[model samples]
Target: MNEFELIQNIFKASVMANTQGRKDILLGIGDDCAQVQVPQGQSLVFSMDTLVEGRHFPFDADPVDIGYRAVATCVSDLAAMGAKPAFFTLGLTIPKSDPQWLAGLAQGMAELAEPIGLTLLGGDTTKGPLTLTLQVHGYVEVRQTPLRSNAKVGDDVYVTGLLGDAAAAVPIVTGEVLVSNERLDYFYDRYWRPTPRLIVGMALKRVVNAMMDISDGLAQDIQHILKASNVGARLEADRVPISAELRQWQPESALSLALTGGDDYELCFTASKEQASEIQLITQTLSLPCTKVGEVASEGFSIEGYDGDISGWQHF
Candidate 1:
């Protein structure tokens, strides 16, 4: 099918599903450009992510997972900044015009976008080696914008939800190792469909002094905050929040995955000591496990009881 027909048949549902009563989006998909209105006194936040086939995912992975992950990863950035998800545009590079694949991809995008109140703002489709690039937009109150460079010395560092599940799924996805169906399913879901902590991020806007998502492993990602904030940290090995699934399935690699595994997508944030109680309340309210893994200090980054590779994922 042609591009126009493909969009009409498959992408229309993604565009129209969230159309009712959406005043923020003045125009979406099929228009020359998407028009949006940033709420009064709120700043617009936007982020983009591109996933390449062989480099980012297994060569023959599910198209539906690709579609969902493309959106989720980009939205993860907005969540870090405590912004409410808005709309997104997609840039697709495909090797062929496969109708079934396109339909599944569109379905994947709609399912994730609809519940989050995200809209399709139209984008470009090109012929290439099967890549997906998504640009997501969000809105946040000016006074509450979370930044990576605001960690105060002595602030407690925290992470939302379990870590390392996605990284643990790499071997399974690439067929490097074998595991039970239940374990495979759990890690695979974490790998392909990461939950963006937008709710906790929004709630953290008033609490956290510094914040970021753990896409490139907690170890390496934490350094970004330390450098930006001009502070160091002492991560407690015992305190890192890890998934039971990871420990149960791969006991030996569990800690490594939790410490340095990329693609966790969980929030890594720092907040003042006085705000600890409030932070606990926020996580409890959202029912997400928030753990204090470290404390911000004047200089130096090190983890107690661990002297291994802490660098997270890097393309090179």
Candidate 2:
């Protein structure tokens, strides 16, 4: 089928199925530009992520997994800023229109978007190498949204959820390593379907001084906050959270992965010392593990005990 037909039969149908109960999206698919009404006393926050085949995912990756993860990883930006997810637009390019693939991709995205209250507003489909660019829109309270540049000296540093699993999964997904079924399942799930920590972000919004999602490795991603906030950090290497599965799989490499591996999607943030008890209470209420890895320093970044490279995922 042609591009327009494919969008109507596959993508538009997916949008209709997933966007139910969303009143914020005033105009959606089939428009030249989608429209939404901004809520009072709130600001619009959006981010775009581009995922290329083979580079971002396995060439043979399932379309559904790709779709789900595309949304998950992109919406993670919103979560970092303590924004509530609202709408997203897709920009899909493929060499050919495969009905089944399109359907799976759409289904995968819809599943993730539904629970998070994200609606499909609009997008473009074109013929080319397989690439998906998703732009997600969220709303945040004006002046209340935490920023990467807001970190202050003496602020406690924290990260939500375990790190390094997604990085470890790369070798397994690419068939470069052999692993047990348990290991395979755990790592695969971590890579393909990471939870976007939206609730945690919202809960910590008022508490955190500076925040950003770990897209690149902590070694690299944390630098952005440090530079932006004009502060430095000294992370305790042992404090970085590693999953039991990863430690069991590769004890020696687990620390490296947790330190320098990418795609964790967990929040790496800083908060004042006074908010420590409240942060603990929030994490307990949410039943999510939030680890205090270090504290913001006056100058210079250092991770004690890890004397290796910190080059995270580089697009170049």
TM-score list, all predictions = 0.97, 0.97
How well is each residue in 104-212 modelled by candidate 1, as lDDT tens digits? 8888887788888888777888888988889899999898988999999999999999988999999888889898888888888999999999999998899899999
Tens digit of lDDT per residue, candidate 2, span 219-268?
A: 99999999999999999999999999889889999999998899889999
Query: For candidate 1, what's the RMSD?
Result: 1.3
Q: After superposition, how far is residue 98 of candidate 1 from its true place, in Å?
A: 1.0
TM-score of predicted structure 2: 0.97
Give model 2's clash tally: 0
